[model samples]
Target: MKNQSPIIEVAELFTISENPNLRIFDGRTGPNAKEEYLKKHLENSVFVDLNSDLAEIDNPKNGGRHPLPKFEDFIKTLGSLGIDKDSHVVIYDDKNGANAAARFWWMLRAVGQTNVQVLNGGLQFAENQNYPLSSGEDSYPETDYISGHQDWQLPQIWMDDVKLATQDSGSVIVDVRESQRYDGITELIDLIAGHIPNAKNFPFIDNLDDDGLFKSPELLKNLYSELFENYDQNKITFHCGSGVTACHSLLALDYAGFDIPNLYVGSWSEWSRNEV
Candidate 1:
C-alpha cells in the first residue's frame, strides 16, 4: 500500500489519537446526524456538520443540496477545529467512508492540506473492532488556518461542463449511483431516475467489499483500470445523487494509485432540475 494512502485502519487511528497534531472528525450526515453524535462518538472526535461545515446549502438548484462551502468560511472552519496546514486530520462517518467522511477528505485535499485521511471502515468498523466510544460533545482550541487558494485545487465541473462532455468522445462522465437509480427504474432521492446521457454507471458501492469496507488498493486499481480502459483519467468526471457519495469513488481512485478525476458537485440533484 502507498505510504500516503488516504485510508487509515481503525487500529492505526486508535494508536495515533494521543498525538498532539492529530485531529479526528465525526462526519456523520443526514437528519438525525447531530443527535447521533450527541449520543455517542469516538473520544476526542469533534463533530463536523456536513451541511454547515462542509457545504453551502443556499439553494439546491444553484449548487445541489450540499454544495462546497465558501473558501474563506471553510478556512475559518478549519481554524475553529484547530486544524492548520500541518494538522493530521482523520475523518470518519457511520456509513463507512461512503458518506460525508469521504467528502470531508476531498474538501481538505482540495485546500492542499495533505495530511488528511478517511478512517477505513468508519465508525461502524471501529465498533466491530471494539474501539472505544465516548458519549457527549467535544471541543478543541481554535488555531489559525491561512489557506492560499480561493477555490478548490482538485478538478470539478459544473452542469455545463457535463453537457459538453456528453458530446465529446474524449470525456467520460461516470455516474456513481446504484444501478436501479441509474437505469431510471427507481427515483427515490432525486426527482428523476435516469442518468445523464453518455454517462457510464459505476456504482460507488462497488468500491467496497461485502464487509462494508473499501476493497484492497490492488483490487481497486485493477477494477478501475478495467472500467476506465483507454479513458483519460483527467477527462473523467464522477458524480452521485447530490455529489456526496461521489467522493467515495474519488477516494477509492486515489487510494488505488490513480489520478483523482473531476467531480460534478451538483450531480443528479442539480442535473434533474435543469432542462438539459
Candidate 2:
C-alpha cells in the first residue's frame, strides 16, 4: 500500500508502532553511527548501515561514493532486515532526512515498495517528542522479500545523459549541495570545488523549516512549482555531492505531490573525477 505521504510525523508513527507489518530502520551514517545507535535508538528499530547495506561502493571515479546496490543484493538486504514487500517501513537519521534515511526511502520507492517513509525531523524530532528509545541492538525475524521488479522502477540518469540534458534549454539540473560547495568557496569532501556547468544551486536545507522539519506540502508545492514550472518532470534532475543527499529534495518533491524526477546517482563525485 502506498503511504498517504512520503514524510511521516513522530505522532503518526506512534499510532502505527504496533502494526504487525511495520518495520523501523535507523539509517544514520558516520564512523560512530552504529555506536550511537547502540547507545540509543528508536525502540525496535534495526540499524541499516549506509556503506554496507544501502550502497555498493567502489571506485568513486566510476560510480560515485554511494551508488545504488544491485537489485538482487538489495532484495537480499531487505530480507535480512526482515522487510517484506508489505512492510510499512519507516527510516530515520540524525541529520534529519538529508542523510541515508532519505536514500533508503528513495531506494524502497524505486523498488516499488510504496509503504515506506522517512520520519520527518528524523531522530532529533522523535527524541524531542519523547518517543520510546532503546539501547543496544534490536532484531527481527528475517523473511524473503518477494519483489516483482527486477530493476529500479524510478527514473535515473547517467553522466552522459546529464551532459546532454545540460545542453537542452528546457531541462534543469539541480545541485542540492550547500551553496559554498556549489559556488567554489570551500569543498571539504570532493576533490574539486564548484558545481556542474549550468546547474542551479538549491541547498537541500531549504526543504526544511527552522524546526528542522519539512515545510508544509502546500508551501513546498508553491516553492518548487515556480522553479520547475517551465519544464516537464522528466526533464528535471537532482544531484548532490555523492548522490546521497539528493534524495532529500526528491522526497520533498514527492511530499509536495509532484512526480519524482531523475536521480543522477553518479553525481559530482563521479563527474569531477571523470571530467577535466
Candidate 3:
C-alpha cells in the first residue's frame, strides 16, 4: 500500500467520500460519545470505542486507564472494522485530533500500515465545512486481517524503564499534559495531581496553532529539537495521562519528519498510582 499523509483535510475527504478504498472511522470517547455518535457522525463513518476496542482496560492501576489492546486482539478488531493492508483509513474525534484520533493513527502506523491518516481539525472542522452527517449506525464488509508480528513496531517504554530514565542523566521523560496538572495544581482526569518525577512538562496543545490545526512542520521540528536537544531520540520518552494524548505529540514528531521517540504508554495514570 502507498503511504498517505498523516493529516487529511475536510475538502480532500469530501472529494473522495465515495472511494471504495476509503474507510472512515470515528474515535470519539466519553460517557455521551456513543449517544452523540448515534445522533450524528460523519456519513458512512464506523464508530470505534476507545475503551473497549482500542484498549484492554483490565487493570487501570497497572496498565493505566486505557492500555492498548493486545496485538492479536487489535488485529481482530481491525478485521471487524473491514481494515486490510490496502485500506486507506481516515480517523477523527470530537477533540480535534488530540484525542483518540491521533492514538488510532499511531496504532495503525505501529502495525506498519501505510495508508492511514487522521482528519485534520477533526469533526468540528468537517461540520464547519458543511460535510454531510448521518444519524445511527453504518456498516461495511469485514475483512480477514492477519497479524505478522507479536508486538507493536513502535518505540514504547514501560513504567520500569521510565523509572530508570528518571535517574539517568542521558535520558529524559517528557510529560505532554497541561501545565497545571504537571505542577500538581489542577488535575481532573487522573487520580493524582502531580506529574512523574523528573519528567518535564511540554503540553500537547503547543503542537497546534490558534485555529486548532497543527502548526507548520518546520516550527514543530524546531520546537521539539530544542526540547530534545540534549538527549538522543532513543533516550527520550513521551507520556501523558493514560497513554492517550501522548500519541498527539508523537503524531506531531512524525509529522515534523523526526524519528518517533519512546512512548511510555502507562504514562502518568499508571505512574501516579504505582508510585503512590
Best by TM-score: 2
lDDT tens digits by residue: candidate 3, 5-104: 6888899999989899999999998899989999999999999988888889977788899999999899999999999988889999998788899899
TM-score, each model? 0.97, 0.98, 0.97
lDDT of 1: 0.91
- In candidate 3, list every pair of residues with a backbone clash: none
User: Model 2 over residues 147-257: C-alpha lDDT tens digits?
Assistant: 898999999999999899889999999999999999999989989998888999989999999999999999999999988988987899999988899999999999999
Q: Which is superior by TM-score, 2 or 3?
A: 2
Cα lDDT, all candidates: 0.91, 0.94, 0.90
Q: Which residue runs does candidate 3 get wrong by more than 4 Å?
A: 1-3
Model 1 per-residue lDDT tens digits across residues 1-276:
343889999989878878999999999988999899999998889999988899988777888878888888999999998899878999999988998999999999999898899999999899888888898998788999977888899999999899999999998999999999999999888777798999999999999999998999999999999888888877899999888999999999999999899999999899888844
**Candidate with more favorable, higher TM-score: 1 or 2:** 2
lDDT of 2: 0.94
Candidate 3 residue-pair clash tally: 0
* Candidates arranged by lDDT, highest first: 2, 1, 3
Superposed model 2: Cα runs more than 4 Å off: 1-3
